[model samples]
Target: MATDPNGTTQSDDAIDPVEEENVSGRASFTASLLTQGRHRFYTLSMPSDVLANTCVVEPRNEDPEEGFQRALDEKRARDIANYIDAGMGTIPTSIVLSAQPAANLQYKRTNRTLSFELNQRAFLILDGQHRVFGFRLAKTSLRVPVVIYNGLNRMEEARLFMDINTKQRPVPNELILDIKRLADTESDAEALMRDVFDLFDKNADSPLLGLMSASERRKGRISRVTFNGAMKAISDSFSGASAEQIYDVLSAYLICCKSGLREYSMEDLIVNPTMFKALMLIFPTIAERVNDRHPSSFTVAHFDEIVSPMFQRSKRAELSNPGKSPSLLVDSFRKALRSGFTIGGGNAV
Candidate 1:
């Protein structure tokens, strides 16, 4: 084995007969020399010390499947592939972190490649950096689509990177949910549900909730805008209301079934104040029969067991007191719910 002055072996491991023939047939490439056919050129840097970091061999990369997908997403892999294909054997190497602020993306050279890998290193994400980084990694294995620029200016590189990622909006939430497992494999679904309930409690009391929840669901469809607006209104008690008032509103809704959770469907609630009172009565009655059930989206069995009896009692009481006010039935139902059945063991149902 013969050693080059650069400490690289010129042994059979490094050079094959075909490569030797090619080297003999062609003159060594010089960075300072360029043909005049094309006016465009890209600039890259190398260390003034030659043997310190001798670049050798063709462009190559070794990465896994997951890495490839992430690179595609960030456009890093694409940029790298493009740079190599444009005949840049060793593109400029910057000993700097990534472009984003507060990022520490240091890079260096290994073999003929300009890389970011270290013996023992960790990467801290700064901003939209994931794309270019991913692109760089992904391109390590594949070829890229590159549009060579004049002098390979730093601003020009920045512009190209920005154009690849910034122009597109993110994918939709439902689609993201479909890929939720990829984002967080160890997620807690039950905890997520509890958080949702807590959020509901936080926003259940508002005229907007009374207004928008009462708004018709259009043709079996509810839009994101509609849902978000309605939810936002009650989030933090109309924004300026006090915590006590917020609690009062929440408690009233919770106690009276003014919010959802009872067997009350859309048809049951067409208006506020009146329909609301009816709910206050009916929910407590129906909520009684279940063993492990909380106030939730009820099925047909719930309606049969709990709701029908309360409705009959309220109706009869209302009719018997005909000379009384128009809201007498609702009043009676509320009273019934207030003085409702037991909670545990044989006392329940």
Candidate 2:
């Protein structure tokens, strides 16, 4: 460790980006830049228990696009709720409004009375907005687990959001697409999500992992091995996929067959055997569609299109013939993959 001329130990602040290369063997300037933010202590944490759901997180009206998007999500929320209920799950709760607060509103904890600007705007949730909204509609207790941030600037929040996500291990394209659709309307969404992600991190040890066939086992192993190195691995895998897309496509090819439009859920899609089996079915189709196409040309819409045929064919096998195999539907999916598709992108705005 180097010492200052005055004898204090040199810290990250003392590193001279102008003169050194980093331990990663990149120019020291790049590493030094990352450490610069270390001196800025902006984060504050409070007990997850004390956090109240007082701030009605309404959609911000400043952005017209936000309102339209919120309206669209509202449309989807009902469908999500139906699916969650059928599957015996719950979605996340929601606030009455959505916005960042300049600071958290002060309130009497037990009495639950607002002490500050009782009528003023409160902070909208950045993440898990749909869950909060859904749970509120269901008339459950409003208090839940959350990480409330003070002075949450939009750009900085976005940056912080992505930063926190990078802490997790990588995921498959289909796997990421599947979980991304989890609506706030699952029966016990927070718990379901925890169970789902817990299973995902633990690998194939969970019941859902057993859906893998011998061939799919080999393929999944290869895919995970190939993607173990980078963040882009998860992005690239999930880049051209979506929760709806993966769910619709995979629901057709299932063998053990648990997840369905009737039983659709964050928990079911992420950890149910039917969902895992569908992933096995989608991957190779994705590879064929790409055919080594332009790198930028890759997208989640392709994955959605890959299974459109299955979705179209099996809208309600529930009433007509629920027991037979969906091989015909799977064949239709393969054909759809061969024909190619055109769909758009994800916009969580």
Q: Which predicted model would earn the best lDDT? A: 2
lDDT of 1 by residue, 1-349 (tens): 6677889777432332221111322211111212344433212232212111121111113334211112224355356446544654443332211222211222222222122222122222112233334333432332111111223233444444455447757766434433454546324532232233234434654322333321233332322233333233345322554445433433444433322323343332323333433443443344444324645434445444444444433444243333423256556665554443555533222
Candidate 2 regions with alpha-carbon error over 4 angstroms: 1-72, 79-120, 164-349
Clash count of each predicted structure: 11, 32
lDDT of each: 0.34, 0.36
| Model 2 lDDT tens row, 1-349 | 5687788886432343232222232111111111235322112121111223334443445465332113226645455445444656543332222334533433332322222222224455545545544543442232233334444455565555456546645554445433444644334432333333334344443333543321122432322222222122223344455444433333332322332233432223333233333335445555454334434343434433333343434435321332333344445445544443334532111
Which ranges in model 1 have alpha carbons more than 4 Å from their true place?
1-140, 152-163, 175-289, 292-349
* Top TM-score hit: 2
What are the candidates' C-alpha RMSDs?
Answer: 19.0, 21.9
